[model samples]
Target chain A: MAICTGCSLLCEDIVASFENGSLKHAKNLCRKGHGHFQAAFTERTRPMIDGEQVTIDKAVERAAEILKSAKSPLLYGWSNCTEEAQSEGIALAEKLGATAEATIACTTSFCEGILMERVLSGKIETCTLDDVRNYADTSIFWGSDPSSSHPRHLSRFSYYPRGEKRQRSYEEERTCIAVDVRRSPTAQLCSNYYFRLPPGGDLPFMEAILAVLDGKIPKVADKKKMIELATVLKKTEWGAIFPGPGLIYSLQDKMELFEQLLARLNEITPFKVVPMVADCNARGFNELLFEKTGHASSVSFNGGSAAYGPEHSVLAAAKKCDAVLAIGSDPLSELPIGTARALAHQPIIAIDPRRSLTTDAAKVVIPSALIGLEAGGTAVRMDGVKIKFEPVMNSELLTDEQILARIMEAV
Target chain B: MVSAMEIYMLLPKTNCKKCGVATCMAFAVGLLGRQKKVDECTPLIEEKKYEAKLKKLREVMAPIEKASETGLIIHPEKCFGCGNCVVACPVNVAAEPTRTAVGLGPEGEKVILRVEDGVVVVNNLKECKRFGPSGTLCNACTATCPSKAIEFV
Candidate 1:
C-alpha cells in the first residue's frame, strides 16, 4: 500500500506494482497521481553538476558550498517534501540565516490569512473530511473545482457517500453549491445552484451572501438566486465550505469577508471551512513552520530573529537571494515565466525524484527517493490531519530527510 | 460506441415533439441514457415505413442492459478526471487496510479506471468487480460519479 503525493488529499490506499524498473500497474491513482508515479521511470534525474554527471557526494558538496558562501541564500520548495525534511530545512535556514518560503508563497495567500489567522488562532470552526462525510449536508465549493483538483473529494467525503448521519447522501439529503468565476465542471454538476462570479468578484459575491443572510436584498445581479442561496444556507443542518485558490487569490488581503461569512453562517447553523490546498504536504510544511515560528509561510530566520512579510516571499526572495535550494518542487515549471527566468539566473540546488524544469536548470541536481513511493514519511492532509505511510518499493536513493541532513552536514 | 447521428438516423426524422424533447437529437441523447424508449416514438412505431429502422434501433440499443449487468461503462467525454470512481471502489480500500474505501484498484495490479489526458478511461475492463458472473454488482462508482459519466451496463 502506498500514499499518493500527487496532491494534498494524500489518498492513502494505493496499490502500485513495479517490474523491470517501471511502474507496471497502480490502483486508486488519479491522473495526477498516475503521472507522478509514472515519473519515477521517465526522466529520472541523476546526480549532476553543470550538466556533467557527478557522484551524489560531489553534488552534495557543491550544493553545500553554494549555500555556505551565499549571504542571503533562499531555502524554498518545502511543500512537496516530508514533514521531517521540512523541519530539517527550517533548521538549515536558521543556521544559514536565510529566507525560507514554500511554493505556496508564490500564489494564493491562503496559508498566511486563513491557515495562520483563523485556523491557528482558533477563530473559525473547522472539521476533518470524515466529519464532513458523516454530518455535512450542504457542501459549498466556493471558487473550487474539486473535480479537477481533489478528485476523490465528492465521492469519499463531501457529497456522494452514505455516511452515518447522511444515510440519504447526495440523492436527497446533500446539496452541492458551486460559486466560481465561470461554469467549471463542478459548477456544471451543481446545475441550477451554480453561481457565476466575475474575476475579482468574490468579495462582492460574499457580501451578497451576507446581505441575503441578513434578510436584505443583495446589491448584485440576479437577486433572486442570491436569495435562494441564502434560503439554502438558512436550512442547512451542517455545511462545509471548501475554498480553492480561485477564492483565495480573489479575496487576497480581504479574506476577512470569508471569516465574517463563516461567522454569520455558524450563528444560524453549523458551518466549516476546509481550504483546497494544492500540494500533498503544503499544509504539513505550513503547520511545521507555524510550530517553529509564528508564521505559516514566507519567513526568514536571519540575524537570530524570525522575520516574516512580503519581503521573505519567494517572488521577492527570487530577486534578493544569490543561492536557492528547491526541494521536491519545480518552480520553473509552475511559477510565472518571469519568475522562472529570474530563478534560473541564480545558482539553484534542486533535489527531486523526477526531472523537471527546475532540476534541468539547477547548477546541482540531487535525485532523492519519492515520498510515499520510494520513501516513507509523514504528511499532513489539506485538512491538517497527520498521515504516515510506509514506502512501497525498495530504493537505493536517499530520502528527502536524509538528503537535506547531508546537505546541512556538508554546509 | 454508437453515434447519436446513427441513433437519430433510425428515428422517424419527423422532428416530432411527441417524445417531450426538443428534437430527434435530444431524443437520441435520451435513448443513450435509457430515459426514452424507441417505442415512445409514436410515428416510428405506428408507421410501417420505419419498421426496419425501429428494429435496427432496438438491436443497436440491445446491449445497454447486458452491458450494465456485466461491467461499468465510463463515458470519457463526460468525465473530468474526478477520481470519484477511483475512490468509491471497495476493492481499492479492502486491498490495503490503511487505504480509503473509495478509490481505483485493489488485489494484484489490475486497474479498472484511470484518468488520462484529464479524462477518465476504463483502462482495465476485466478488473472491475462487476465484470464476471460472481461479480458483486458494486455500483459505487456509478452512484458517486458527479457527471453521470459512469454507467453500470
Candidate 2:
C-alpha cells in the first residue's frame, strides 16, 4: 500500500508497481500527487553552495555560518514535514534566537487557530471524516472547494459512499451544498444546490443563513434561495460544514459570525466544522502550537522571551529579519510576489526534495527526504486524527528532522 | 494612438498608495508599457464594469499577461472526486463532471486527470488566470500519494 502525500488527505489506499526504475502501474493517485511522486526522478536538488553542488557537510556548515553570523533569522516551513522535524526545527529556531513559522503566512490569523482553539477548548462540535461519511446526512462546503483541493473527499467521506448509517448514500441519504465565489468542482457536483456569493460576501451570506435559520427573511440578493438552504440546514440529521481559505481570508477579523452560525446550527441538529488546510500537517502544526503555545501562529521564542502575535508573523517578521531558513515550502511561488521577492533578496537557506523557485534562488539548498516515502513520522489529519507511518521507499538522504537537528547542532 | 474611451478605461482605480504612485490613473499610465497583473487593479476587478470590460482590458494589458501551453489533465479513474483539486487549484480548471461516474475504478478514487489520445491534455489552458495551470503541479496531492503512483513529467 502506498501513501499519497499530495495533500492532507494522506490517502493510504494506493497500488503501484515499480518497472524500469519508475512507477508504471498506479491506482488512486491524483494529478498533483502524481507530479509529487514523479518529482523523485526529476529536478532533484543537491547540496549546493553559490549554484555549485557541494558536500552535505559543507552546505550544512554554510547554512550554520549564515545563521550564526546573522542577528535576526526567520525559520519557516514546517507544515510539510513531520511533528518530530517540526520540533527539531523549533529547537533550532530557539537556539539561534530566530523567529520560526509555518509554510502558509500567519495562517492562524486566517482562522484555523480560532477554530482549533475552540475545538480544543470545547467551544464547538466536531467529528472525524470517517464519522462524517458514516453518519453525516448533510454536507456544507462553506467558502471551500474540496474538488480541486482534497479530490477524494466526497467519495471517501463527506458526500459519497454508503456507510454504516448512510445505507442509501448519494441517492437518498446524502445532501451536499457548496458556498463559494466560483462555481467550484464541489459546487458543480452539488449542481442546483450550489450557491454563489461575491468575493468577500461570506459575512452577509452567513447573516442571511442565520436569519433564515431563525425563520426571519434574510436581507440579501437571493432571499428565497437562502430560505430554501436554511430549511435544508434546519432539517439535517447530521450536518458538517467544511470551511476553506476563502472564508478565512474574507472574514479576517470577523470570525465571530462563523462561530455564531455554528452555535445556531447545533441548536437544531448535530453540526461539525472541518477546516480545509492546504498541507498534510497543517493540522498537526495547529495542534502542536495550540498545545505548546496556546496559539496557532506567530509564535517566537527569541532571547528567552516568547512573544506571539500577528506582528510576529512571517509576513511582518520577514521584513525585520536579516536571514531566512525556508524548508519544505515555496513561499516564492505561493505568496504574493512582493513578499516572495523580499524573502528571496535576503540571505536564504532552502531545504526541499525537489527544485522550486525558492530553492533556485536560495543561498543554501539542503535536499531532504520525502515524508511517508523517504522518511517516517507522525502527522495530524485534517480532522485531528494522528496518523503514524513508515517510509515506503528507501532513501539515503536526510529527513527534515535529521537536517533540522544537524542545523541546530551547527548553530 | 489612444482614444478618449480608452483613456477613461485606464483611469486610476485605487487611492491606496501602496503602489507609491498617487492615483490609479497614473498607475495605469505607468502600466502602459510595463507588466501589470489584473490583481493590481485591486479595486477595479470589483467594479460592475469588470466582466463587461474584461475583454478590452485584457487586450490593452496584453504585455502584462504571460502565455504558457501546459494545462492539467484529469484522470477520472484515480480521482477521489473530493474536489480538493478543484478548490486548491488557483485556476478554476478542475471542475465537477456534469454527469456522474457510472462505474469506473472506485466511486471516488476513480477521478482521473482528463486525458486525450495517448497523451494527457488539458483544455482551455490559455484562459486560466492562475499563475500556473488550473491543475498546476502544486504537488500538494503528491504529498499524500499513498500508492506513489502519481507522477510528474
Candidate 3:
C-alpha cells in the first residue's frame, strides 16, 4: 500500500503495480490521482541551465550559484513537496537569509490562510476528517466543491460512508448543504439544500444563517427556506463547514462574519470548520511554518530571522526578491500575469519532477523525484492529520529533501 | 455512459426491428438500460464493416455486464472511493445504529457496498435491498454518486 500525493487528502490506501519501469496498474486512484501516478512517464525534467541541457552536478552548482549571489532570494512553492523537504527548505531559507514561503501564500493572503490561523490557534473549533465521518451530521459546503477538487472527500469522510452515528437512518440522516455562487457538483449533491448565492453573497448568506439562528425572519425573499436551513443547523448534533476559495475570496477582510457565524452555530450546537485547501502538502507547510514562526502560511527569513508580513507572501515577494528557488510549484502559469512576469525575469531555480512553465523559463532546473511515488516522506492532510508514506518505486532522481539539502550544502 | 444519440450513432440506424425492439432509439435506450444486447444488432455485429463500432459499443456496455443482483454496477476505474454509494445504501444504515451515529465502516457489517482500497466493492449481496423478490429498486447509492460511477441496469 502506498499514499497518493494527488491532493491534500493524500489517500493512504493506494495499491499500485509496476511492470518493467512503468506503472502497470493502480487501485484506489481517483481520476486526478490516476493522472498523477501516470506523471512518471511524461515531461520528465532533466538538469538544465540557460535553456541548455547540463549534468545534475552542474545544475545543482548553478542553482547554488544563483541563490548564493542574490541579496534577496524568495523560495516559493512548498505545498506540493513533502514535510521533510519543507524542513530542509526552511533551513536553506534561514541559511541563505532568504525569504521562503509556501506556494499557497499566493492565496493565503485572502483565501484559507486567515481561517487556517484561527483553526491552528484553536480559536475556532476544528475536527479531523475522521471526526467528520464519525460524528458530523450537517455538512455545509460553503463555497467549496469537494467533487471537483477532492473527489473522494464525500465518500471518504464528509457525506458518504456509513458512519457510527449515521447508520440508524436513510439519506436524510446526513444533510449536505452547499452555499456557493454557482451550482457545483457538490451543490448538485446537496440538491434542495443548495443555496445558490451571487459572487459576493457569502456575507449576506452568513448573516441570514445568523438571523435564522436568532429565531428572527431574514431579509432574503426566501425567508421560509432560510428558517428551514437555520433549523437544520440548530438541530445539528455535530456540523462541519468546509470552506473553499469561494467563501474566502468573497469574505476577504470581513472574515469576522464567518467567525461570528461559527460562534453562533456553536452556541446552539457543535460546529467545526475545515478550509478546503487543494494542495497535497498545504496543511503540512502551514503547520510547519506555524511551528517555526507564529504565522501559518507565508513568511520571510531575511536578516537572520523569520519575519511574516503581507510583503513576505510569494505574490508580494516576487517584486522584491532578486532570485527565486521554486520547488514543486509553477508560478509562471498559475499566478497572475504581472506577478508571473515579475518572477519570470528573475534568476529561477526550479526543482520539479515534470517540466512546467516555471522550469521552462527557469535559470536553473534540477528535477527532483515525485513524492509518494518515486520518493516518500510525511505530509499533513487537509484537516491537519499527519500521514507518513514510503516510496513505492525507485528512481535515480533525488528527492526534494535531498535536493534542498544539497542546495543548503552548496549555499 | 453516453446519451442515446451517441448510442444511436453507433447503431445501424436502419430502424430495423431485427433485435425485437421497435425503433433504433428504443434499442439505444434498451442498450443503456441493459435491456438490449449490442450483439443482438445483426448489422453491427455480423458485418465486418461495423467491427469498430461493435468493439466501441462493447467497451461502453461492458460495465453493465458486471452489475450484481441489484443491477448496481460500479466502474472501479472511475471510482475514487468517495463513499456516496456505501453511505447512501439503506441496507448499511438499517443494519447499524447508535455508537454516535457516524464513523461506521460498511465493510463487514451493515451494507452490501463497501469502499475497499479506494474503490467501492459489494459485500453481503443477500442483505441488499435490491436483492430477492421482496427487494425494491432502491438507488440511493447510484443517484448520489457524483462521478456517475455507480449505475443500475
Cα RMSD for candidates in order: 6.7, 16.0, 5.3
Q: Write the per-residue lDDT of candidate 2 for residues A1-411, one digit (tens) a residue.
A: 777677788777655555565666565565666666766677888999889999999999999899888776777767788989877776676677644332222334445666666676667678898888778999988888876787677756786555668766665778899888988767877876888889898998888888898889898987788888988888899998888888877756786888898888989998998888778887777777666667665476666656776677777777777888887677678767777888989988999998999899899999989887789999888888888888877789999998888887887
Model 1 scores a C-alpha lDDT of: 0.77
**Sort by DockQ, top down from the best:** 3, 1, 2
TM-score list, all predictions: 0.81, 0.73, 0.84
Off by over 4 Å in 3: A98-110, A169-172, B1-83, B86-132
- Model 1, span A2-56: residue lDDT tens: 8888888897766678899888876557666777788778888999999999999
Candidate 2 wrong stretches, greater than 4 Å: A98-114, B1-153
The segments of candidate 1 whose C-alpha lies over 4 angstroms from its true place after superposition are A98-117, B1-72, B76-148, B151-153
Across residues A1-411, which tens digit of lDDT does each residue of candidate 3 receive?
878888999887677888886778765566677778888888999999999999999999989888888877888888888899988887887778743332224235446777788889888899999888878888999889998899878867887665667653336578899988888878988888989898898888888888888887888989989988987887899999999998878766787888888888888889998899888988888788788877887777766677776766777788887898888678787888999999999999999999999999998999899998988889989999999988988888999999888888988
Decide which is better by lDDT, 1 or 3. 3
Clashes of each: 9, 57, 15
Instruction: Give lDDT tens digits, candidate 1, residues B76-143.
Output: 66774666665556554444323233222334444554554445666456666776668776786776
Which candidate has the highest lDDT of all?
3
Q: What would you estimate as the lDDT of candidate 2?
A: 0.68
CA shift at A238, candidate 3, in angstroms? Answer: 1.0
In model 2, what is the error at residue A338, expressed in angstroms? Answer: 2.0
In candidate 1, position B18 carries an lDDT of 94
lDDT of 3 by residue, B16-42 (tens): 899998899999999876677787899
What is each model's TM-score for chain A? 0.95, 0.95, 0.96
